[model samples]
Target: MESSFSYKQTVPSEWVDYNGHMNDAEYNRAFSLATDAFIDHIGLDAKGREQYQYTIFTLETHTCYLKEMHEGKEFEVVARVFDYDAKRIHLFLTMYNADGEVVSTLEEMLMGMDQDEGRPAPFPDLVAEKVEAEYKVNAGEDTPKQVGRTIGIRRK
Candidate 1:
């Protein structure tokens, strides 16, 4: 969560809840938008996906809220490539407040899907190269605490 983020967003009125802060669902929406931006960064925007007949699909996500975000407040997100293979990827996205503090985190598992075949598929060569670049860029950084968390109830 300490790495610098490249994507930023300002909280909107619609995202505010009766509690006078951004709602839980709105946090997910923001993260989803960031994910789309990451897809574009990897050169798999709509047009590129069409050419490759492939796209990344979110298979699972775990979110952890660490701080409050009010409407009109600016936030940032950095998507780090936690791990990946030919067909699957685990991404760690950290959300930060204007003061550069961790506000939230989302760890998502994604899969490459072949639209033409309607099944799981390997990332195309170009995309694979990009992903490896991402991995290499973040490999030296420490893994966030929220990564790979399992939900459960503690026994006393």
Candidate 2:
């Protein structure tokens, strides 16, 4: 129910590319950081993962660059659990600039995995409950219009 403000950072100079904007890969890096924080919030934190040998693996990702971001820009990511089941989570995140303009969006599919067996696994009971509760809290959220879009040009 609370706003899920998970990650924040200033765009580093090293992230800028020849065109003078943050590089494509750097967006991914930012998203990854936000995702880590979200999972930890839901109880699959680093210490628990190491103790249980369980973790979430990103199965797929889609990113939409809605606006260009430059070095020195401060930004933050807000995440929502969108949907989930016992073994998988469908997640979405939006990156916003300091002035609150939308900069980018990311959709990701992640699967819980058992490191010992190297296979998919259901989330631990507590984690599953937390995820479902978070999903319910986010149920009123309008799915971002950019979600589920494929990269292609409209033919004239």
Candidate 3:
């Protein structure tokens, strides 16, 4: 198993939808926040952005909602760096309940951005080293089923 980063969060009442479960957008929001935390952990926080003019932008994301979560519920996200290079990162985040049952999964590709040029750029050497280390630590684990899933109708 991979050594994943954990981010704990509480479901807010405002995130509930008409059916009383957390809205679809909220799931993405939670994942986004977790992604921010991961970025900060990898030394890409506000200070790093200011110093190196570098940051991260989500290139794409695929989220699978496995179980409905209600308002006031406590959840945690476990994040892993599945892969990364000089300019991109492939990550997987799983949201789990207090009991450790998975509630959602998100697979994402993120690009490192150069703020001054407002375009993709390779990470600075220090940041690249950290990202590579994270990827190496996580890539050796058993792959989760949600990774690389495509959305389509499958015939029985």
Candidate 4:
């Protein structure tokens, strides 16, 4: 619940594309790892899965590639909760290179679901409380434009 939750990862060779940089898919992978870390921080993990039968599924995502990353590069991902309702949460993630420069940013919308029914459901009360606490603790001082954004082409 600090300003950001950080996770370190090494770029794998398979993540490199013909362009010789980390492929677009790997960006999502890194963000996904960060998401998992957040979930764990809030007490959601294999045990939560077994007991609550609840999990998050990504509904939408927007990623901006600001700089290229290469295979074997050590990088870090910082994630924070931007917003949340009963069933959905908005998260912002920044991928940083070894030098701490932001290499990419991703915004994602995730929905809590009942794994058995595959239907949307409100987050469990305990999980909801934890998430709310985290949001309060981590909300950034500056209002980031990425929060509550919709995908579209801008008209100049």
Question: Any runs in candidate 3 off by more than 4 Å, and if so which?
Answer: none
What does candidate 3 score in Cα RMSD to the true structure? 1.3
Per-model TM values vs. the true structure: 0.95, 0.93, 0.94, 0.86
Q: List candidate 1 segments past 4 Å from native.
A: 1-5
For each candidate, the alpha-carbon lDDT, in order, equals 0.90, 0.89, 0.91, 0.83
Q: Write model 4 residue lDDT over 1-156, tens digit each, in one string.
A: 245367899999999999999998988888888888877766678899778999888898888888999989999887777789998888888888999888988888888988888899999899999878868867665655655567689999
The sequence of per-residue lDDT tens digits that candidate 1 reaches over residues 1-156 is 333336899999999999999999999999999999888888799899989999989999999999999989999999899999998889899899999899999999989999999999999999999888888878877777898889999999
Tell me, by lDDT, which candidate is best: 3
Model 1 poorest ten-residue lDDT run: 1-10
Candidate 2 residue lDDT tens string, 55-143 = 99999999998899999999989888888999999998889999899899999999999999999999988888988987887798677
TM-score of 2: 0.93
**Superior by lDDT: candidate 1 or candidate 2:** 1
> Cα miss at 14, model 2 (Å)?
0.5
Greater TM-score among 1 and 2 belongs to 1
Clashes of each: 0, 0, 0, 0
Q: Which ten contiguous residues of candidate 3 have the minimum total lDDT? A: 1-10
Backbone-clash count (model 3) = 0
**Which wins on lDDT, candidate 2 or candidate 3?**
3
